[model samples]
Target: MSNSPSRSVIVTGASGGIGRAVAERLAADGMSVLVHYAGNPATAEEVVAGITASGGTATSFGGDVADETAMANLFEHATTIFGGIDVVVNAAGIMPLAPVATMDLETFDRVQRTNVRGTFVVSQLAARSVRAGGAIINFSTSVTRLQLPTYGAYAMSKGAVEALTLILARELRGKDVTVNVVAPGPTATPLFFEGKPQEVIDRIAGANPMERLGTPQDIAETTAFLAGPARWVNGQVIYTNGGAA
Candidate 1:
């Protein structure tokens, strides 16, 4: 990692939603960004274009987050482009809601592959390569605490992610790199709304004290804090939900 004047960050799943918001917010904060997408180059390019139009520095990359070689290549590309990476946000995750008993093995395994293995791969690279003062932000979910039905597989995957992130934080001691998990509640994104009925959404939105679902910007603010000044907040899962759990 180079000691550049401005920081550089890699935001996986940054083509849309919370990841996209994080990438944009960090770029607005003056860090060069590498927007990463799993299967969507066009959306990633849109994100990059938006950042560049706003006078921020950004580019796009595509890779399978769960694939070790692909993610390793991603890290190398970021280093090659930005001189060095200072922050890595493991925001790439997939949530497939299903009862553990009824869910097939394929779905459950897919969830783990993307949410757990994906985070591990990116985090491993970040742990070794991120600058001394860098940070690693991993995504979890409040469903782990809520224990909601139909969320068993998703919650289990996120649970693994949380554990991995916390342990990584301790492992990175003396390296000045902070590792933390951001567990969000029911946020209004395509991912959250997918296949969920309107009544279910309304009920969830009203369950929180805020009486509304969390927006992508709400999550992004927390991420920005972690990636920048919240150096002491390590090894903890900060829930970004509106008091939902």
Candidate 2:
């Protein structure tokens, strides 16, 4: 087997939450990581610091995941820093909850732009750049399956992600690169807890057979598998929701 240090990953939105966890996990497994952040450079830097402190190779880059030029530059920058790219994880996204009837076009467009367009832009770059046997892991949501109220727009964006992931896997035929999606359900991130009442949180948690919210580490474990050893699992969505379905 090739040495683990030879592999490198670009994880968008790596400042915190699932992204940070994924970056850290990949680094711990001996892959170099590019911790991409959209807005908070400090947090992204902190993630890099933590990785380095653990004797893991990591660096932080700032850019909008939806911009084609910016993302291309990010891919190039990561290559320059790490020698080559083996995994691309589209973990950067936004979630705004509102019923379809009450949702304004601005909010709808914003979510679609970041979640759908961003994934497309990143996947396009990854398709063009990933090495043979590399992996492209996109983020989706279990809400796409649960179909809860106020998640219409968010679910719509993730639905598009699922479509993109499967099709891209086929497009990369013969390249030995795998494209897949990781759909998390009600993860215990700061953004998930905001504005949610304890009763509401508990109810959602109980809906899952595990009876608890998923940690960022839980989602990271799934990502680590797809990025490294799960070659046969391509063009599919792995719902890491503790049996919420």
Candidate 3:
């Protein structure tokens, strides 16, 4: 891994949640990371600060992942600052739950634009820009397989992401750039705990064989594997769900 520090990554939604964890983890693996946030610069800066404090290489950038122009600029900035891009992680997404029968059209569209369009924009850029031996990782939910209620729109959007990732991996054949998805079960991020009582949380936790919720680091570990050492693990969905499905 002596050549690892020369590698740089662009991680969308690095302001918090799994994205932040990924930024920190990848930086620890000796990669310079471009931490991106959609709205909160302060949070993103904190992630940057933490990495630098630990003697790691990282910086923060902000943009709407759904905007091709903005994302292109983000890629350019990462390449300019880090010398070149090696990996791209599309962790920016929004999940608003509403049953399809009563789901607001506006909310549904917003979900599609941010989750589906955002992943598309980032993955498209990564396909063209990421260096060989790199990886493009997209986020999806185990809910797609679990078929949970009120996740119709969110799951539908991610279904498209799964399809996109699989095909993009093939399209990049012989390019040495791998494409994959990380579908996590109930993770214990603050975002996950929000608005949920202990009973609900416990019930969800008990459903899994792990008998607990996954931490951000759990997902990040799997991502680090794909980004660094798992070259042959291409074009697949690695469910980091503790066998919940």
Residue pairs whose backbone atoms clash in candidate 2? none
Give per-residue CA lDDT, model 2, range 16-121, as digits (tens).
9999999999999999999999999999999999999999999899899999999999999998998889999999999988899999999999999999999999
Best by TM-score: 2
Query: When superposed on Cα atoms, how far off is each prediction in RMSD?
Result: 1.9, 0.9, 1.0
Per residue, candidate 3 scores C-alpha lDDT tens digits across 215-241 of 999999999998898988999998998
Instruction: Give lDDT: candidate 2, residue 214.
Output: 99
Candidate numbers sorted by lDDT from highest down: 2, 1, 3
For TM-score, candidate 2 versus 3, the one ahead is 2
Q: What TM value does model 3 have?
A: 0.98
- Residue by residue across 28-140, what tens digits does model 1's lDDT show? 88899999999999999999999999988898989999999999999999999989999999899998888778999999999999998899899999999998889999999
Instruction: Spell out the clash pairs found in candidate 1.
Output: none
What clash count goes with each model?
Answer: 0, 0, 0
Looking at candidate 2, the ten consecutive residues that score lowest on lDDT are 1-10
